[model samples]
Target: MTGPVVVGVDGSSACMAAAWWAAREAVDRHAPLHLVHSWTSQPLDVPISQDAHSERLYGREVLRRTEAELLHRHGDLAVTTDLVAAPAAQALLARGGDAELLVLGSRGHGSVAGFLLGSTALRVVGLTRCPAVVVRADDPTVGAGRDRLVAADRDEVVVGVPEPGPAAEALLEFAFATADAHGDLLRAVTVVPGSPGPRAEEERRAWLAAELAPWREKYPKVTVAERVAVGPAAQLLLTSCGRSRLLIVGRRPHPSHLVWKLGPVAHAAVRHAACPVAVVPHG
Candidate 1:
């Protein structure tokens, strides 16, 4: 949390929404907000005319306008802007290396469809060392009229708790910290593969409680609820998002020889969750 919160801006409604979200998060963390826009020259192989100078100007304008709007909404917030001459994904990664968090917006196809993450956002989320949050552009909660920057009293921060290990520990650390920051309830959920008997169910619940004990001690003021369900992990987590202000899931680094990939649960949550989703890489 040493650096400012960085958000990618492309002059789209989606990026604007993400900028707003990032502003609130920055305020909560007592950090600055940085808006970044990247532009690149067209490949020589393409026949279409492309003006690198014009594109650079447009990128600067986008950053300036976005910075103005965010400062308007959050007058006291420390805001900065950058125009990078590189591809979107590359620029974001380089800027986000020391950031507290990287925020991006995902477009929704329609009411029935979930998020449609663009290539830049997907790649950044997969590879970023810091936590990446994907905010839906069409989220009703985000807008100019919203007066409250903090989460509601009843809102909860839901985190998908994987098997007990380093990954789960990292995920819960973020979830508890966020919930404590906003004074929201923390809900930790785990979904097993198959239906279990009464004894097994009891055992699972006990295990979940044991897993959360240390976190509870660490954040004694933060209230926590543990839930254990039997079903697909992604579906259950997505269902929980309706009541959650933020949904968190964990992603493990891919093998050295292969490209980084988002695990099944993290991928599904970012794509379909009703609330803003944070993907944290651990282990």
Candidate 2:
């Protein structure tokens, strides 16, 4: 929780947008902003003459340009840059182990494209030890001329509360902490399958309230809104993203030996959500 906010940059427009988002987040959390650019040699089949050297040089330039832009926007913010010789996901996971939050960019054109066919961004989010946020290059909330303070006050933080147990505590904790920091409203939502009767809806509401009780007490200043709906979890959550500044979802930890995959809801969120999506790993 005390480490700097780390973001991966690959000299793409999407990564640059994510870097900007990470800069504002770092400032809000009073943490340093670390820019990581990872590059590796060309494949064995391809000609390797001077390719590795050129890639390294390009990586450094990308980091330098990103660092300068962030510092220009946030004059007093502490910023650092790193050029690593590794795959993007590997480099990010290594640096993000001690970070408070890991931010990455998604180049997917739409939900159908879905993280551009599950590339580095998806891999990093699935395996990251710390919370990971996936931001799109075209996200409306992140750009020049958008006042950070005003946006914080106007937008809400939407969190998907799937169940009431220790597993959900981490998700709720992040949501409440974020809303508290920004002085924004926290919208906690849970979805039930198909249509339910009044009694079922009431029970679901009670469950959601119980899950959020401790967090509400912990962050009394943060306003809370509970929403229980009947439909697909991913669908409902995606709809909520339109009015939200940040969407938080939970990812159950998977074994290291197994192929990493995000849950349906979290997968949809990171890939399709209109706003920035934070995938927090929980037990």
Candidate 3:
């Protein structure tokens, strides 16, 4: 981690939740917290409105109040606030330059004012230079849902490893670290394309175990659960991920693509998963 954890704020409930989540992440990573609110004085197509100045001032006030509340809750944590004069997504992308990780709400109240992560967040996450974690609107608070995995007594980190190759190394490492940090179990899953025979299932199980062997030794405290399901990747993950604290998936970094490069499974997880989704870019 090279820089602070940057979270986008828009005075919406979702944005506040994301900020709270980012604060906890900053604590975990031992990094500073930056609360940012991006605003544009001039609209892309329309001319500047008479109330543009007041709107900008309101953005600053939102940042100020958000900063204060976070400080009140975490007095010892180093925090900073910024008001960027750029489009929401553009400002966030620029801020990510100095961020170790960027956190945002999955969806916001709207695009004009509240930090709605809907389109802007998707755009930022698609083109982000740093890893972006999307916190759902209804995510449970730290005091309420930190370790609350559905139907499970202990928290479990679920990672979707599409393949047992280098592409998944980053995903596995993140999952293992997260699980170890929470003293939880790590569940590594790979969804096959179609129904698998008993022999194929056995082979996949073996392969999953082999791929995760080194990770298991590296984090002895982390219990590793391996699974190979036969079905569409997205469906399998959405079905099994309900019992995990966090669902992590990998994306191939392709700056030249000019569009979001998340595969089907990752895209689905982000859109539907019940827990926080971390999209780790790997080679």
Which ten residues in a row are the worst by lDDT in model 2?
111-120
* Model 1 ranges off by over 4 Å: 41-49, 109-117, 144-154, 193-195
Cα lDDT over the full model 1? 0.77
Residue-by-residue lDDT tens digits, candidate 2, 1-283:
5799998876676777788889888988889999887766222222345677887887788888888888878999999888888776778788878999999876644531111224546777888889999887777667643354234433799999877665579999999999988778899989764569888899888888888888899999999988899888999998876678899999987778245688998888876787889999888
Return the lDDT, model 1, position 59. Answer: 71
Model 3 lDDT at residue 15: 72
Clashing pairs in 3: 10-115, 108-116, 108-117
TM, every model: 0.89, 0.89, 0.84
Q: If both were scored by TM-score, which would come out higher, candidate 2 or candidate 3? A: 2
Over 4 Å off, model 2: 41-49, 111-117, 145-154, 193-195
Quote the lDDT for 44 in model 2. 22
lDDT of 1 by residue, 1-283 (tens): 4689998877766777788889988988889998887656222222333777787877788788888877887899999888877777777778778998998876653221111135546777888888998887776446543475434533789999988798889999999988988778899998664667777778878888988998899999899988888888899887776668799999997766136667888888877887788999888
- Write candidate 3's Cα lDDT for 1-283 as tens digits: 5499998887776677778778777776678999888766322332345687877887788789888877776778899888887777887788887787888775522231236334556667777777788876566423333342233442777888867566778888877877876777788888654557988888888888888989889999998877788887778876776567678887877758467656776677778777777887777
- Local error of candidate 3 at residue 209 (angstroms): 1.3
Distance from true location, Cα of 113 in model 2, Å:
10
lDDT of 2 at 247: 95
Model 3: residue 147 alpha-carbon error in angstroms: 14
